[model samples]
Target: MRLERAVDDFVVQLASERGLSANTAKAYRSDLDALAAFAGGRGAHDTSDLDLELLRDWLWQDSRSGLAKSTIARRSAAARGLTAWLAREGHTTADAGARLRAPKADQHLPRVLTRSQVDGILDSLAALAATGDPVAVRDVALIELLYASALRVGELVGLDLGSLDRSRLTVRVTGKGSKDRVVPFGVPALRAIDEYLATARPKLAARNSAEETTAIFLGARGKRINSRTVYQLVASLLADLPGTGPAGPHALRHTAATHLLDGGADLRAVQELLGHASLGTTQLYTHVSAARLKDTYRVAHPRA
Candidate 1:
């Protein structure tokens, strides 16, 4: 019934029932632990003993300690989750703190690139592929698949050569929380992968200290390509093309999702491709789609 023991139970519940990522569990645990520590000196040693005023005092301490708004919101959520679980388990008679409020946080719009800009970027990569540099070919494939499939950088780089079905034009990638999904790319990505495997990979492998790496994408040293390298590569490529914003791998992801929605792809299908557990996460793209729609209407409609 102690505070720490309750956190342990909550973590187990999260892991067994909620399927939260380990990092996510750690974050929630930290929030709960801080609350436990805050309430430790007080008489509130367990869930039943805690009160709404105690919860408010904890949040006040967080504010005085200079936690960010987002952080405070998360802590508030942690408090609510704990109380909810306690009520469900019959430790508390009612969810007294359920009505408690959290701080209002700033919202930022996700930046996405135009489809034409993506085409231009891929065209530039195609030129690099024509140089007969197999790595350059692989680079083209990597960029193409990333934009085409809307893969997270981790999902893209974590891919193994064995998981790719070039005949089907699909690659199996494990997304966040180790959930697997099959993502398809275009023929251009296929051709790039082929060239990389046939020419560039062998050359890079021959230079390796070991036999070879199973990584579908290899570095200059013939090991699995890492996330940082992919991020840098995308940034450098976007730098050469003028007027792009924050050209990380995620920008490609946002661009792909936005373009899918723009091109009449169903929201549910795109959600599956993007590995979102909820359609609500996918629905954010609808806002992007609607804004584009309004812009198009303003230019084309004479209804004013």
Candidate 2:
């Protein structure tokens, strides 16, 4: 069987059998396509020609070209999965990439903001809210709840009016793995949301097509806000902050989780709040929390 056919099968397998989201399945397809192209370059145009040595060479080329270790590891996993599928389908006699070793990815701790830092960012948003532009209220609310709930940008933008329970202070979120969890937001987020609802959302909803009006957040054009718009909004906000590093919606999520842990929230409880399935996934916040502790001690201990 051709690599293209195998990739089509794998994508279907990911969507139907493995229960992957459409975007995730698309990413796997892309990775497999890249792997197939690399295999073709190495004279392994088909499953029969693909072997461990050829796969390693492909990974080597990617590493030498400055691709991240995590990316190369993911490509190797894609190859291993494809070759295993080929063997199971009897398209190949054996899985060639099954024994291939992948490089270890760096596990650096995520950046988190201090309480004062978070306050400053939100204060800046509040200043923008004072613009009385109505949309400014919505942007402030968007950033507030994103950090308050630690939601992925998809979940934040995908939010519908029906998904929020103001009485319960929880919002129903569909997270990764297609799992739904009710996440709680703090009073600050609630205040921001109230301002948006009272002033901004109504104004935006008025101009939008009735058919496209269910979303909680609206763009300047009276439609659902695109993910890229949200990304640029967050990037613009963070660009003025003190830290010079990667900043997006996920930075707020990271900041929220670390702050929750620093405030002495239980690890499992924080995981549940973040909708993380694994406690290990939530454990990274500990590194952030610990760094804060060390910084405080170093400043105040006076133990020269």
- Least accurate 10 contiguous residues by lDDT in model 2: 237-246
Candidate 2 wrong stretches, greater than 4 Å = none
Residue pairs of candidate 2 with colliding backbone atoms: none
**What tens-digit string does per-residue lDDT give for candidate 2 at 1-304?**
6777788888898688767766778778988898888777766666788888888888898899999998888888878888888888898998898898878988777767677888887898899889888778889999899989999998998899999999888899888778889999988888889889889988887777665677899998789998899999988877867764468888889999998888889999999998887898899899878877898999999892
Estimate, for each residue in 1-304, the C-alpha lDDT of model 1 and write its tens digit.
Answer: 7878988898889877877766688999999999998898776887777788889998988889898888888999988999899889988898757986789755544667777788888898889878877678778878988987899998888898888998899999987777889988889778777877887877766667766678888877878888999999998877766543577898889889999988899999999999999999899989977877897899999992
How many backbone clashes can be found in candidate 2? 0
lDDT of 2 at 209: 62
Question: What is the model-wide C-alpha lDDT for candidate 1?
Answer: 0.84
- Screening candidate 1 with a backbone cut-off below 3 angstroms (N, C-alpha, C), the clashing residue pairs are none
